[model samples]
Target: MPNTQQLQDLTTQVRRDILRMVHKVNSGHPGGSLGCAEFFVSLYQNIMDRKETFDMDGIGEDLFFLSNGHISPVFYSVLARSGYFPVNELNTFRLINSRLQGHPTTHEGLPGVRVASGSLGQGFSVALGAAETKKLNHDKHLVYSLHGDGELQEGQNWEGIMYAAANNIDNIISTIDLNGQQIDGATDDVLPMGSLRAKFEAFGWTVVDIEQGNDIDAILTGMAEAKALTGKGKPVCVLLKTVMGNGVDFMMHTHAWHGKAPNDEQLEIGLAQNPETLGDY
Candidate 1:
């Protein structure tokens, strides 16, 4: 497991990567990426069953899926920083021929990624399928998935949730980036996710809540609890409460910055709040 200082550094680096990648590409999502940085860093550095060596089948390790593929910047940064690939490859994010597309895909044969996800709400089912396959193989490794609050509006997600609970796929743990704001506006303003915790409970899944979405320690603790709750014949869901653009002040409270790239001046200001701990990509 990564030490506290290393985890903090990793999260800072991931946030920097999110900003730099989006500014370079001029067209990737940053709001969600920034908000989810700590969670991704904590997972790769402390929680997930990942290593420098990766296998497509994940024979003896845990798996992670990004259902809300729009947050690719944070996911790609975390994967690279975790040694899935060279950190320098992050410079090619969203470029013409780069494996780091606007969204993640196994089509590029990326070592760490197993599924192609961009269409939203599909990853939950993909994760469930992988978990079920692990059961068939008698593998004890678990599967984890992340979904956007807005993506929950997709009908496929409910289907996946029902399937996982009905079949008692207890080895999977899924989290929602409950930043309360999506591309359009506040989640409550756009489409209210009424009592998400209660909804999951009513669906027969155990639910946990993490109040501080940007804090690495809090995220780690919540994940540990969720993991412990697993294998008792119920899947787990973490309702993570986060701000849309967590680290950057200007980007934080509005939907305007959801997919907007910061100009040079804006970049400087944003980076000021999150100092460079690990070297920039």
Candidate 2:
């Protein structure tokens, strides 16, 4: 039962974490990470039914996978701030021997991360497998995952989509970060994915549109609607539209910040915009 204001504070703090972690290491993806701040905040804090303790084989609770692991800053920040691990650990991001890598790795034994992502286009299938197992064991909890819209360029995702529809894997809710930008350039300029909604529906999924992916309230409502659409004999997909570099003014509408760390001066500007909501880690 997290209140809206508390969620906002956490979202601000997560943005702060994303900016600072990258600034320290002079590497990591910040654009998509910043864009997904509210979605991760709302999901971990209020949307998903999670256990107090972390477990590898999440048998009786909801599970989440990060198909687009390059945005580990936002995921790590929200997971740490939500009590999955110590918030201070974010300081070690991307350093040698640190559990926090550029992309999440299960080998590090990080409590919140479930898979080794960043290869792209593999998460939807992983989530579908988890969802199917929940049914095999008669567990009612759901499986949630996030995929970058640009990552859909991988061919394996199409196979995963076809499998889910043919088998009616209705317990998984996968959201695509429809920011329309990727590392190389704008998605359209790089490898255009026309009509994500129509594509998903054609693949036999119940699709929902979250026009404001950066807004906490909109994400909560849209995700709840997506959850409601589950268990009705169809898989669910949410087309989450967002602006890259969402919180920081200079970074907002461009792809330049996709995987670049901010300089000291830029860090100051970014931090100034977010302010210290729940105190920086």
Candidate 3:
């Protein structure tokens, strides 16, 4: 079993992976991807009961869906590091016909990616369907999903939230990356969905909060708690309050980096802030 220290190192490495992938391509979303590095690392390394080989059906293993697929850098890093594919493939990020696209898609047959989540708000619906499928198949595995806080404004998420709870779909845990920043500007400046915790609770789902979404230990513990809360009678929601550009000095506290790639000098600065934990990809 990996310890907290290992998880921290993995998180740091994933951050490095995110920065480098985006820098190399001069495209891809790094801010949200960086913000979610710790969560993705913890989920793949500690939470999910995954298989050694890829299975599209995921018959007997935990399944994960990326609701905000723009954060593909972090997802791709974790999946590659988790043995889903070669770590070197990250070099193809955003290139023509690359599996590691600006957003993840099953069309490329990427091993760890299950859904094509680019349009936003649809992945939550797809995750709920996967949870329901698990119930019908009598599979005891859980389905996990991550959504952007701004994406909640899309309206379809509420329908999924209401549907999961009314049906008692307790096998799924949907997490909102509550970084408070999106592409255009801060979520508040754009369109704020106040009190996500209360919102989910009102929708009949149980809610857990990780006030420090960048902290590795908190994520590991909170995820464990979320898993325990599952298999009961309600779908669980995690409000992960992360910094938009976590681990980078200049990247934090702004929405400008949401979809923008860092230049060479800026990339150097970001890498210096993160150091070289477990080496770059």
CA lDDT of every candidate: 0.89, 0.94, 0.91
Off by over 4 Å in 2: none
Off by over 4 Å in 3: none
RMSD to native for every prediction?
A: 1.0, 0.7, 0.9
lDDT of candidate 2 over 1-281, digit per residue (tens): 98989999989989999999999999999999999999999999999999989998898999999999999999999999989899999999999999998899899899988889989999988999989899999999999999998999999999999999999999999999999998888999999988999999999999999999999899999999999999999999999999999999999989999999999999999999999989988
Ranking by lDDT: 2, 3, 1
Candidate 2 CA-lDDT value? 0.94
Candidate 1 structure quality by residue, lDDT tens digits, 35-138 = 99889988888898765698898888999999999899999998888888989999999898889988999888777899988898898899999999999999
Please give the range of 10 consecutive residues that has the lowest summed lDDT in model 3: 272-281
Which 10 consecutive positions of candidate 2 have the poorest summed lDDT?
106-115
Superposition TM-score, candidate 3 onto the true structure: 0.98
Best by lDDT: 2
